[model samples]
Target: MKSHWREYIHCDPKILIGKPVVKGTRLSVEFLLGLFAEGWTEDQVLENYPTLTLEGLRAVFAFASECISQEVWYAASMVNQTQ
Candidate 1:
């Protein structure tokens, strides 16, 4: 079954100023994405941050994909308009 991002991700004003984060943890989606961008593998992340699970990692990607898709749609809509 496809993992739902909402199952593992959360955002609260009390947490990182409402940045989307892994539920029950303070790890932000942006921070996790940055780890991968910096060449950290799944094993590296899991080993270093035992609190994070494989599913939580997947949720982070899912959340980011959703955000990018929305951004892409908005950008496409403005493609023909003057900046």
Candidate 2:
């Protein structure tokens, strides 16, 4: 969708002690990641957080995916060492 997920995830020194949170909401991307990891569905998350939208959820996932992807090189190195 050519989306700018960065718009949805950011940290501000003045807010939440600089945790990466949703841009317009106080909810942190880490919180959402935890919910998803705990087996919470997108529908369930939205139901619990009426302020959140599908787009927001998608953005968080995209942002997290990008961050995790950057960590892949380290994992690759570990895998190479084990070979």
Candidate 3:
């Protein structure tokens, strides 16, 4: 398991408005995360989406983690000052 989202996921302006998706599939990372949020198990996800692999699922999480980790949260006061 490389644990690298880039290895399994990609974004294209031609696909889903440039949202990240598993390679070779139209499924978006947000959609998959929503499925898990709605109580869909890994097995169930795999069963429903045969094109998705365990590695791809892991990549989704990895991509999300990277995105969250890189996010910058601005303070309300700072935002107000900038306005």
Candidate 4:
């Protein structure tokens, strides 16, 4: 089955400088992640952003996980090297 994140999150150039956002809302994924970093609970987030659903929250996490998993890292010294 398709991941819930794929269904719930999207990026549009016209929205928040193309940041990934919850579908049908202007809430950016970065903002959502920040809330969690600030110690906001799932219930608190739901209460504050009434437009967001539990599944949407899960999607945000999933999207972040997917992004991190696919990221490639290089040492700072490698910046000057050519392929």
Model 3 C-alpha lDDT per residue in residues 1-83, reported as the tens digit of each score: 33567999999999999999999899999999999999999999999999999999999999999888789989899999999
Give each model's clash number.
0, 0, 0, 0
Q: Would you estimate the TM-scores of all the predictions?
A: 0.82, 0.77, 0.82, 0.82
In candidate 1, which residue pairs get closer than 3 Å at backbone N, Cα or C atoms, i.e. clash? none
Residue 45 of model 2, lDDT score: 93
The digit string of per-residue lDDT tens for model 2 on 5-76 reads 876778998888998887878788899999999999999999999888788888888888778777736577
Best by lDDT: 3
Which is the better candidate, 1 or 2, if ranked by lDDT?
Answer: 1
Question: Candidate 1 residues 1-83, lDDT tens each?
Answer: 13499999989999999999999889999999999999999999989999999999888999898888677355655876855
TM-score of candidate 4 relative to the true fold: 0.82
Looking at candidate 2, the ten consecutive residues that score lowest on lDDT are 1-10
| CA lDDT, every model vs. true structure | 0.89, 0.83, 0.92, 0.90
What's the true lDDT of residue 68 in model 2? 79
Clash count (model 3, backbone only): 0
Candidate 4 worst ten-residue window by lDDT: 74-83
* Candidate 2 TM-score, C-alpha based: 0.77
Once fitted onto the true fold, the runs of candidate 4 whose alpha carbons sit more than 4 angstroms away are 73-83
| Runs in model 1 lying further than 4 Å from the true structure | 1-3, 73-83
RMSD of each: 3.3, 3.3, 3.2, 3.7
- Comparing candidate 2 with candidate 3, which one achieves the higher TM-score? 3
